[model samples]
Target: MGSALVTLGGAESVVIERSRVKTLLALGGCVLFVVGSVAIWRAESPVIGILGLVTFGVFGAYILHALFRSGPGLVVDDEGFTDQSSAGAVGRVLWADVTELGTWSHQGANVLVVGLRNPEDYVARLSAVSRRYARVNLSMMGTPVTIASTGLKTDYDSLFALMNERLERSRLRLDSNPPRT
Candidate 1:
């Protein structure tokens, strides 16, 4: 659907674009959501019906927008990583602040958990809505910033490998030259 990795400015900068196939799949889900919303409305379930209608309506609208949207889902550079791959993703996590990086699965979806030196500072950058979601992620995954591989153009293995390699190099560079006070 899209290139897995795009090197910008030699091999120093790279961007992982979202998959068109994933976007189509999301669009299909939106259609199902609309259908379910209508079915719920007709089944005399007012409370659940209203919730379904509103929830599905908002999600469907966002999916439609995602279909046409195309950009770097994840950006990795010498500085750090910018995760735009997940819903309410964090913008930047500098290499200096990243202490650990790993992945886990929840509800059949793979989640990438990036351990930060100051997690609270990153959590504070989120908007009101994103902050709410981040709290749930923090509770479930123990890290507010988690990337899921579902909508990404690159597969989980490839993304993880690239990230690990870059992180190692960053750590080595940081270790060799301590920051000036």
Candidate 2:
């Protein structure tokens, strides 16, 4: 993942793109898994082969989509941040709505979990597949907006720091200038 601070008009935004090398490596692993599943079917057990195929196939499709998808995986701007880092990304989360920012570990991968005031609103807007993932995220992390740096250009720490900084700035701004009724 590559990240840049871009200024458009008077607003500055941080844009983080996906890493092709990392994505390709993940795709390669998926291919290997599928091949191994085939081998298992040929020699060992059809049940395990079928299970592996279904599991790895879904992952392969997701990785393929990420590989071909252009543009930044995550963007943090003046109003809010847009998360496209994963298949279940909850896009355009306003800083005002974010109640907390915390971390979680999922299968050894560090995940940045954003706590929202109205998580259900975000989950309702997601696609069916994404919604299922969002439900799981809510159950596991207590929020539906969980971002992982699996295929992205940045590390978990950097991503978390950037987001934390932005969220703080937003909160300070809001504190100083209260919304007029």
Candidate 3:
């Protein structure tokens, strides 16, 4: 693992956090932009075509705005890895705190979920922040500790390796046949 300066709150879990509105606007905008552009091209009347073109611009902005809401950064320590940028946002859970570890792909991004013992509180917060992002997951353990990535950090392989190493050191192993679904 690369040597990195350990900062405060960089213990077992680290998360870069953000608000939900940002995510919604961003996703909705992207979809609208593409659809609108195509609609504008197919429209018969010039006025309708212009209106479609205008929607394309608005939607493009929404995508960008949503991207900004999901703060980007790396959250890792002895516990888990959080690939996020927002402050005070919970990221990953320490293996000592994790009961299950699973890696999956969602929304064209490879994601890892470290299931903790009691995860209700964190999961609730995550649900609130991810109104627009559809790639969230949750399952129960004892005291759930969790972490997620913003797909904006260094790399997934490196983070996974580091997290695994830390979890192994804690004697908490992932499932023998963890699904990569």
Candidate 4:
């Protein structure tokens, strides 16, 4: 079971760091894929090789970056959550804009899907590459913000519960003291 570091400062927050062990494992797998892709390219088809290189090679680079990168992968605070878990991460998302929280399964991995009231607002904040990926996520998952615990220290369930709790608290605060007009 994975656990997040919950800080009870002035404002409550959960900080989830990247799992070095999991990241190393992913990097190892990517290296294998790259090696296999190279072998296939030389012994099999150039087209397949190029495809594998393009795909796995790029992914390998990302994993490499994550391996060396420091700081928390995900941070859930009073305002919102910051996601640096994947290439398609959408920096930060406020609780007020989040409409719903749900889960999605992809290739046996459970992803925490955050439904926003105006998804385009968040989508527009991403880069061109991430924007395209976010669009794909929107089409398939009905939201652009999908948090996967692939390299994060916590699992999907833990992340979901923490976010749900924070969102609920934000809602209660908002209800008790409505925002001024």
Candidate 5:
């Protein structure tokens, strides 16, 4: 686990890279998906077998991607935050559009959900499965940007504090300088 304050894209950024735990968990998921795929292949129901194959194909791709993934999983700068932690994450969320920040439990995993001013637009941009999850998050968690802390090297509370502080700063800056008409 490591962290660094570095300049990214001409901005000073706090980069929190993913931990080995995340890599291990991803590998574990790959193994489970493989096993499930094999089990489903042997099942008498053809429909079930096909479903398993689909699951394997989807999760298998994610597993392979995770294996090769590198660099900071999360990056916080003056403008906004970029999330590469979750599969098919929104990529980035500007501090200006961030409406709320809170935590929720999804499948026993603690996630930080960032509410946006216009979640629908972002949700529409996601892939089918990611869009589905985003919708579920909206209905269940009240947000479209749900970030799992499991992948991050930084502690969730500290990260939350940093984000909140930055959000406040962004708001203050905007308030102080209204856009010229």
Candidate 6:
């Protein structure tokens, strides 16, 4: 076999990132939202107060959920990377199928990319993170492939190690193939 890394499956692919900073920001926002909502409720405008409460609930849920799930240690399995995969859970690409491994800074962070023959499957998997249905994993003119980042985890080394190991194991095309445009 090729290089092997002990892949451990868990609640998250990797450890939680330093979400404390983000959590503080979100918690601050949630507190403001709750306060604003309560203020509205007491302002003699029941309608506005109700709307504020609803808004508060939405903001609270989003911030809380993001805080809890925003862990570090994102990993790739036999199928695909954890929770990050749009298609399913695990995603594995045959070496022959991948065009290249691209490194690009997305939203201020470096990401690992794997190009594919048809991006439909990959696009579908990233729908939740994409704003539009037609804009999942895309460059300019539309291409099939995927880009997974370490997000805020900042563990590029570990992520790359796993990815490279997985690719070698899968036998994806490498320098032998032509590069991308």
State candidate 6's TM-score.
0.43
lDDT of candidate 5 over 59-178, digit per residue (tens): 667555655677678898899998887665777889889997887765766678798999898889888977876787789877778876666787677777878888888899999999
lDDT for residue 7 in candidate 4, whole number 0-100:
67
Q: Please, what are the lDDT tens digits per residue for candidate 1 over residues 1-181? A: 3344556666567777877678678768877877787788788776777788788777666556555655677888887888876556778989888888898976666667888888878889988866876787788777787876666777777777777888999989988999899
- Name the TM-score of candidate 5: 0.74
Task: Estimate the TM-score for candidate 1.
Answer: 0.77
Worst 10 residues of 3 by lDDT: 131-140
Misplaced by over 4 Å in model 1 are 1-11, 37-70
Which pairs of residues have clashing backbones in candidate 4?
A: none
Off by over 4 Å in 3: 1-72, 80-89, 106-108, 125-127, 130-136, 139-150, 172-181
Model 4 residue 1 CA deviation (Å) reads: 5.9
Best by lDDT, which number?
2
**Candidate 3 structure quality by residue, lDDT tens digits, 1-181:** 2225546653444333343454555566667666766676686656776676776665455345445654435555554555443322345444555666667676776656566665565555554444222223442322233233442333557656766767775563345545487
User: Is candidate 1 or 4 superior in lDDT?
Assistant: 4
Work out the TM-score per prediction: 0.77, 0.87, 0.47, 0.84, 0.74, 0.43
RMSD of each: 3.1, 2.1, 9.3, 2.4, 3.6, 8.9
The worst-scoring run of ten residues by lDDT in candidate 6 lies at 82-91
After aligning candidate 2 to the native by TM-score, how far in Å is the CA of 165 from where it should be?
Answer: 0.7
Instruction: Give lDDT tens digits, candidate 6, residues 55-77.
Output: 77765664555555533324444
Give all candidates' CA lDDT scores.
Answer: 0.76, 0.88, 0.51, 0.86, 0.78, 0.51
All candidates in order of TM-score, best leading: 2, 4, 1, 5, 3, 6
Greater TM-score among 2 and 4 belongs to 2
